[model samples]
Target: MLRTGASRLALRSIAGPAARPAAPSFTPPLQWTSRLSSMASRRPQLPPMRQLTPIQGAVLRRAMVGKIDRKAEDRYQHEKLEPHPELVTTTSSVRSAFSEVATPEAPKDVDMMARVKYDFTTIKDTFDLSAVPRQAYLIGLAGVLPYLATSISTVYCAWEINHSVAGYGYFLSAQTAEQLLHFLEPLQVGYGAVILSFLGAIHWGLEFAGYGGNHGYKRYAIGVVAPAVAWPTILMPVEYALITQFMAFTVLYYVDTRAATRGWTPSWYGIYRFVLTFIVGASIVLSLVGRGEVADHIKGIPGAVDRMKNLKDDAQQALSHQEEGIGAQKAADAAKED
Candidate 1:
């Protein structure tokens, strides 16, 4: 009986939930199966294949070769169209480019000449002188204003010259000084007169150019004034005189003479044509006749600029002589000291 009971107990124990190999550990297998199912569902996908045929590759390669050959031929046709070294860079071409890069660029003379031509054209466009549209009173005032001022200034300058000459003549105790003074006084008077008259002429010329709507005249005027303003501060000793005369002549040449030569119509030439004609004709006449009569003829002429160049030349020569004399005196003094 006991054996029978023991065998039954042993059988029950082996079949029990805790003693039957724990149902062969089924949770692990189930967990593994679930994990495998999830991994299969999450797998990556691949793209479809692009099947390029052998014939297609051959065609593409041939096209590329044809393009490169065409490009080479084009480069040959244009001398400057050298092959790109990286793309088709030739050793000689690279060396040439490098050498050129090292060399300095040539000066642009053509550009400078073109600029001068443009400036010349601009200067020729401004010239007009008519006061008819202005009130008669204003016109008369403008005309007489400069003249009155000029005359007054001239008379004052002449009086000063005469006084100086008379004083020198008295001091000299002879009439020789008076005779020399007479000639010299007139020369001084002539210079002042010319300077004043030129002031008016220059003013009139510029006014005409401005009214005539010539942009070139404006540039010429600007050039004239520029010199006048620059000389006051510039370091050069000759700048004062040279700049003044340059300003005057430059304005006259570019604004008045050039425009006149171009056949521009004036509202009124007035006596200007006859005046200029006479002055020019007289200069020729004096030059041809004799030096003794030159002064006599110049007294009758209207324009002042015709004689200015000669006067400036004379003044510059005098200045040079004075400087030379000073230098010689200094040298003589140094020798005496030695």
Candidate 2:
């Protein structure tokens, strides 16, 4: 029994505080402490942030903070802008800006005498007569025959009338001359108007040929109006009508010359027109001179006046002889009665 008791005491001492209950205190439980220690070991730490110094803060402010103030300083500088060299204020520079650099000189008047001489000298060289077709020349020459014949007949008629009146002492009673002249004068006027209208038709033809547009129509209109102007003048007296025809020819010549100058017609056309118009105008003037009243006025000049005075003296002598014969007959009858 003593031995068993001693063994029990030794076992108790060895087993020590395990047989007693644990007191609750601030100490964590073993499972919780173990979990916390494991989490602390796994977690990552962050680095510390650094603070800026005063000098660095000042530099940042200067570089970025006051840009508006710096721009204001740049805008209002003291120096003036340089002017362009061409815009300098010298007299020559100012004059060059205002004055024209390449103005042409005014045209001088042409010397008419020199022009005439030049034309005469260069006629054959300048004019290529062969360039005109043979048919054109022949037709143009044939057209002049009417004017020539009419003019010649007029002058002959005038000469015959003057001879009859002055030599035979009375006007010619023949109606043939007057009738022919009356017929021819209107014929000439009508023919002239027809020719003028025909010239206008040439413009219309040109318009249709290629120049068809507003300008061509305008040319045609001018031609039409020219003929209308000629038609009304036909009703005037023969002399006045001839004068109008002359004026009309002059106007046509001017217009055609301008047209030729403008390259609307062949170069030689102006010369041909001038020649034809001259002949026509001369014929008209001759016809005018052949009128009876105009011829009488021409014959009233010095030589014709002397011839008329001699005829008057001869008539007076014949009348005096007739009266002397009548008186002698009367005196002889009276003597027979006594």
Best candidate according to TM-score: 2
**lDDT against true structure, model 1:** 0.41
User: How do the predictions measure up, each by TM-score?
Assistant: 0.22, 0.47
- Residue 207 of model 2 has an lDDT of 67
Report the lDDT tens digits of candidate 1 across residue range 1-338.
Answer: 12244333333333222222334544458878787888667532211122323544334334334224777787788867444333332223334554543223333343547768877876543322343334643553454344334333333333333445424422342234334333433333333234334533454465566645555644355445534443332222221322343344334434444444443424333323333323333322322223222233123322234356668889999999999999999999999999
- lDDT tens digits, residue span 1-40, model 2: 1224433333333322223356677878999898898866
What 10-residue stretch in candidate 1 is worst by lDDT? 233-242
What 10-residue stretch in candidate 2 is worst by lDDT?
Answer: 43-52
How does each model score on lDDT?
A: 0.41, 0.63
Give candidate 2 regions above 4 Å deviation: 1-120, 125-128, 165-174, 211-214, 292-338
- lDDT measured at residue 29 in model 2 versus the true structure, 0 to 100: 92
For model 1, name the residue pairs that clash: 85-89, 122-216, 125-214, 126-214, 128-208
